[model samples]
Target: MRRHTLSTAVTLCFAASLAAAASAPSEARPASPPASQTARQQARVPVLVDCFFHPEVRPTDFVLACGDGNSRLTSLHWSRWGQASAKAVGVNIVNDCKPYCAAGRFHSYPVVVRLDRAQPWKKRPHLQHYSRMTLEYPAGRPDTFPPTVTYPLWN
Candidate 1:
């Protein structure tokens, strides 16, 4: 009888503590924002759109060849990413295509990447995206490529 009473008392105490905790307001809860602040927060910044139409900022890797897996940029370290332009240093991996594209070997070359000419994205007028890309090979480059090359980026 003593054990049964003691167990009942403990259970009742536990239930009361839980109820008190449930009624207490949380101190870590964030306060609601004003209407103007919410609108300002929703405003989009300039970005680089990938082949898949995804907006990216300071991406570590990006595809240069969207049609075939021939070329790409990897190990990117962006020094600047602003409304007008962005710059980075990375490796440009290209396929040699010695025998043929199917039997090609990939090679890596150090490159300096720059993106500029920001304009309103065609798909999303409210957002801006870079429209041009220039790559400069500091040390060595592919046999067919020059020291620098500029290409129009897809919107």
Candidate 2:
């Protein structure tokens, strides 16, 4: 008789639990955004592609002269990196080539770097890259360079 009472009580408790669960509200899930909105959010920022085709953002050092390492940017501090443009301040190290290309002294000049004209990268169409780079020397520029110069970055 005791065993029968205990079994009845256990079954009652189990049935009550099921009933409570059936009446409970379902857990809510966040609604997903529209496909267009998701795509826009996922759009990648423009990057500076290195000579080896590696993308870089806020690089401390970058080689402007990929072939001979004659000119480069060092100690870069980027102020802005946006969809349309990017800006930075760094030192432009230029090889003077006083005697010849093989034997030249590198000179440092204070410069403001601006990257603009963003377009879809040919190598990675889903992403964008800065196509143009303009360098403005604030003071003591390299002898071979003007106060301001612009170059078309390789795609």
| Residue 16, candidate 1: C-alpha displacement in angstroms | 58
Number of backbone collisions per candidate: 0, 0
What tens-digit string does per-residue lDDT give for candidate 2 at 1-155? Answer: 57455545554564465456446554432355675765464365788888667667778988898766678899999999989899999999887765654445668999999999999889878868899999999999987678899999999
Give each prediction's root-mean-square deviation over alpha carbons.
Answer: 19.4, 24.9
lDDT value for model 1: 0.78
Error of 2 at 116 (Å): 0.3
Candidate models: Cα lDDT each: 0.78, 0.79
- Worst 10-residue lDDT window for candidate 2 reads 21-30
Minimal lDDT window, size 10, model 1: 36-45
How many Å off is the CA of 122 in candidate 1?
Answer: 0.5
TM-score of each: 0.72, 0.72
- Clashes (candidate 2): 0
